[model samples]
Target: MKKLTLPATVPVKELAERLSVSGPELIKYLMGNGVMASLNQSVDFDTAALAADHFGFEAESEEAVAEAAPASTRRRHPLLDQSRADPKSLVARPPVVTVLGHVDHGKTSLLDAIRETAVASGEAGGITQKIGAYQVEKSGRKITFIDTPGHEAFTAMRARGADVTDIAVLVVAADDGVMPQTEEAIQHVRSAEVPIIVALNKIDKDGANPDRILQQLADRGLVSSDYGGDVTVVRTSAKTGEGVTDLLDMILLTADAEVEPKADPKVGAVGTVIESHRDPGRGPVATVLVQNGTLRVGDYIVAGQVYGRIRALLDERGERMQQAAPSTPAVVTGLSGVAEAGDVFQVMANERSARSLAEERGFAAKQQQAQPVRRITLADLASQVAEGSVKSLNVIVKAEANGSLEALRGQIEKIEDPNVKVVIVASGVGPVGEADVNLAAVTDSIVIGFNVRPDDRAKAAADTQGVDVRYYDVIYQIADDIAKAIKGLYEPTFVDVFQGRAEVRQVFTVDGRPAIAGSHVIDGRIPRNSICTVLRDGKQIARSRVAVLKRFKDDVREVARGYDCGITLEDFGDFAVGDVLEAYTVEQQNL
Candidate 1:
């Protein structure tokens, strides 16, 4: 049979042409396999493989074919060829190591023991504030270590395309065994395709159980070399400073076996920005891992949108360094702006060229930012649910009263899915505020309001941050909506659009009924029976629809701006002079 090579994804027409089959015939074959696609629609490698097999051909991914291809040239170090580096300049560089594990797993303590920095004592609650790269000498060789908080920070950097880690030291507490965060760290390093050396920490404690920990590791597919596996397990106690040297030796051994052994130090310095922040004393500063060449003081450098000549180079200890060599981490000052984590930095020829390059990159970044950012919408969560990757449906609930708040929290927490969990990251009683929206935005959660509404600042923040804000007057509707959304069976079309705001000038009641607000439409027109929130003293007291809208003696559909009108709201009768009435229409969203 003829063999065919294909990319990771190919359109139906393109795949058909490559497989020597007609487009309709390929479509027919795809339909027979229960896949519905047009000729121009793209299909993944597996789908393409099925189609190719039906056409009397064997399909292999382009990557698989390349791996089996004959060598045409000498294999050069992957990092060196980027700079057109001279082979003579290539020499062994220190391996960059990242310490990752669960919180309270002694990762920071182990680093403090190795580097002797006492950083864990100064940190609030012993959690590292941020990730920074530093180097420590083991015997005659040096190894760079990055003190990361957890797997979240680890994967966040890789998502930006920086592949800096050479080896991963997974610190698992002997007593804690395999924690959720430990599993997450393992998953991240495996995805990054780096070598791992297990550091079984906290061995000196009475509760430490190394055997159970090792068994847990074996269960997670990280069997020890004693059991015919490649993983190296080193026992260490950060408190007593035991087996620290052996772990370092194992790191060097793994680096020799895994990382590219040589780098060209004679070339211009190119590195990744580990993390950057504003220093009150030193302006914009960044901890950069020098990957390929020497980074020197006064060198012009450009990282993403920022460019500046380095005024000073400081080590992780705050000590001054004249230059940073390959595999060294330097805290650099004098950047034009704060570079983001994982931004690749390179030394430029001069200030002029660096500024030009920075400006060009800044423009391109802005253009890319125009694309929609990934948000944790119900649709997005539903897809993750299908893949069994979604761990939690985080929610921020805000209701009208404390009783209602408790009720909503109980109902939302009771929702259970075998694949995904429902977690209330934050909940409170009141109108949704800006802080609530911000928390929801960072946590990728939905902000649900029951019998309450969000303020103007929160509304704007939700829109800008792409946060999903839902308002429901009914209590059980919240849980019902979430359940349907997770199963991909529910997508409500009703979306809130701001109508207008009105200020109360008079308060009265007709026929001893609910209080009515005689007000002036200050901004836009207030539609009849639209969602209206009554606010007093800049705080929302009630969220409901306008029960009645009128102008003088004539009942009107809406009251326009610069006009006075009479308005009555549902579920709210208490009216105070100078209270603001905000209106919004519930319209069907296009998508």
Candidate 2:
């Protein structure tokens, strides 16, 4: 047999094209071995190796594969090549900070007060919905603020092993004290191991008590700086803008307390995506904070599973820019797709090589996806527990009704342990189908059906595929079974709640009863039936439902890619243009 030559870099879609298959088919191949990927996703050498094996080919080392390719195809970006310069050679960079707290805590207001911008007036519910990063110069020093979702999105990012935060601005309403979200913010900040700057907001409220807020902070081990503690507590009212400058000054001082990392402008680029979205005009756009190297126009870049040559670069203010360096957040255009938020982005070499490598990777991915996935059995579970291969017990749950499905999924996530993750893949109110079975089979995951039964074909398929399909009527048994399986992994489940945020784009009047709005699909996919808050300008105008979806008026379901579509809201009618809509979903884990 002739030896097959595999390229080091492969574009996933191209590989699918080469095989005359779809991207999802290739994804299924890799997923068969517990590796989850989307059609546009890129796979590395190891993943490609696995794919090659499944395709009956000899796997080559990534380095070896790269050498076999043309030199032009293996070129490296200048920015990435200089990632390790001395700290003294680095330029002063802005401190990336996250503003977090409970609802109505004036988190957005404080940011508005700092930026001197009217962002607060554009958000829904008066709470910051998306993770926005912007820089402001205070007393000749630059400070970057990352407005994280006050809800579950922050936790979701952490759950993905990507902690894209530096400092945390914990905004606690003086009257509200330490509310649920406040504590959650504290936990998230602590989990990221970042420094905290407590902003006692809403002090202008009649019930405001900064002293009580400080006491609450002390209870949470966040002692104030005035009281001889490391954490800085600034009292500021977003309404009156009182003590806001002092807060900025303190932020600069705190930033000075930390050592800065050096940036090698001559080396390869390394950065983090503060935010990313697919714009109709610009394609894949990412607001990237160049951390270690300089980024320039025409640079080929790899961000998460996507790669493309930079077509244009714009600053946070929407101004065109030629280059951006450490700590500067620039919106870069031209990517294979919108990279996931919090994904690390690296500048690559030429576009041809980038595309080639991307294609090879895609081919390898397809091979892996076509392979049969191993199912998780009791024996395999025991071994996985012993070997810690099962850090989380994943489940694809389906139920007879929406309400029961939601409740059961929620309850299952509440099982609590830090080591196990209870993931509900595709949950709907319907009979368990082949799609569910296929997902479970490929993920080595379990299928839990509540008051719902799989069809004979699905059951037979599950059996033939060696998948475990567990039926449950009682919610507790379902929870218990998952809990036991997690225990078998020896790592207790940690029920950490995660939040995701999306922006509303355009609103359409559905039958004139309630309005369905088009939203810029932000951070995560807008799960069907998740509660949504609609904001006109910056204030939350109403709460609504994603009643029905018509993609380009075709009457289909589920919209991604920040695409504009006609959607019907349940029992609501007030929607306007330029109003931000935030849809959030909460995820619970066992810990």
Candidate 3:
């Protein structure tokens, strides 16, 4: 059988040709699998794999193939300790931890209690900490706690390839058995492969059932050791100082038993930027967690594309420090610009080499893989509503995670309108597929996607059927949009529709004119005067409007695949050979 290597998404016509079959025949096969797609419409990897199998072909995704590479030859993350450094120089370091749980649960309260107890127990004068992380000493051993907005930020940093948390302290309220956010946190921590130590909070409250909470944790696969499981459970209350020290001890014990984090302090400092901002007095300030080596004042450091010599180093207590050891988080000032959260920070030899390396990284990452999540704020969707404008507003909710699904549905139902009512026609998890669009078309409902995009089949179906689909990353936007729509203040949302993709095979430069990329339409059709993005090595390099397009010396509106053409971008001049251009058109969608 023939073997095919497929990207995350593939156009139907292109896949049909690769399968040595007609386009209609492939469409028939897709219909048999309940996937509706036109010849030019793209399909995800799973769908394409099934089609390839029907024709006696083996298909594998690019990601799977990369993961199958030999471990010896594959490059490792530069920040990891196992990547380099001599074994003789390695020394034991404290484990960094993050507290996560439901919103009402005492995650912040637990952190505050630890800090307060730390000061009251034996520590000398303590200053109010403003840095994103802090360390507390127990029995002469220090434990770092990263202050973040629960598992959302924790999971986000991990997604960027920074495993900052060595242990996850899951704070579960005794009163509430297990909420949606608690379950979500558990899934995220488990996926990160971090050891979880349950902090059963609110045991001091009336009718706070610790047994019920322990049973709920077991149901979620985090069984306590008392129940014959390996998970460590600690009972504590932020209201009173009960079991707070035990929680800290549990962190230390878990660290020693599971994660023996060590690093060579003699080498240059390497850390992860937890937070950064433009401080009016201090300039660009960054809160970094030192994972290896020792970061000292006057050390040249590079965090992502920004690099500068550290002028000052301060701990989480806001006290000046000469150096920060492994597992110690410090606030540093003197970076050229504000480093992004989760960016790897490395101490370099000198200023010149650091600047050169930073410049090279900046050019390569002209646009980093840091694709911003589509965040639609409340102010963007907020509008005054007119009474009796909408009798009923229908919607179909879809998300990438199930934990947020029920909460989103409940938030939508809670929106009170004087005359109109909100109705959820259908709700599900995963990407929006053809079946979702079909349901929306028949029910007169708009599809709402949270932190997920629609598949090619769904996009094509929605476009053809005139069904509106709105996507948002944060839940606040979805709730606000629904509230506004029900109040008769419905505002239209604009989305990008995939047009086609082109690959630059060659470059032609004429005298006294701009250079044109000799490109071939690899899939679908590239229309003239459309928005285009230049992608090199799977990373977006530039995005601009199509200024000029031609085919064989003649101005044409669109050039389809299997045809060669010349194209020029409006504002982009740097076009390398092998660069792929993805074309798109703006579409306005409304409730």
Clashes of each: 0, 57, 0
User: Per-residue CA lDDT of candidate 2, range 289-389, in tens?
Assistant: 77766888888877666788888877555667888777777788889987777666666555654565456555665786677554455445646766777
Ranked candidates (TM-score, high to low): 3, 1, 2
User: Among these predicted structures, which one has the highest lDDT?
Assistant: 3
Give the Cα error of residue 8 in candidate 3, in Å. Answer: 24
lDDT of 1 by residue, 1-591 (tens): 445677899988567545434466678889999999986699999999988787766677877756877633222222223323345768999888899888899998898788663232233234333337766776678888877666656655664556677789999999889985686567556656678899999998889898898889898779988678888999999998898888988988888877765676766688889889998999999999888879999999887789999999877656688998988888899999999987878777677667766775666568657876444567666667667666778787888887998888889888887767787766667788765665565456788899888899878777767787888888788898788766756664668899899999999998999998999999999999899988989998989888899899888999889999999887888999999999998865523
Deviation from native of the Cα of residue 22 in model 3, angstroms: 52
Give me the displacement of residue 364 in model 3, in angstroms: 1.6
Q: Model-by-model lDDT, in order?
A: 0.78, 0.65, 0.78
C-alpha lDDT (0 to 100) for residue 359 of candidate 1: 71
Residue lDDT tens for model 3, 341-444: 97887876678656755675675465433543232222232332254333666677888887988888888888876666677766767888765665555445
Please identify which of the two predictions, 1 or 2, would achieve the higher lDDT against the true structure. Answer: 1
lDDT of 1: 0.78
**Ranking of all predicted structures according to lDDT, beginning with the best and ending with the worst:** 3, 1, 2
Candidate 1, superposed: residue stretches over 4 Å from native: 1-89, 117-131, 365-371, 374-591
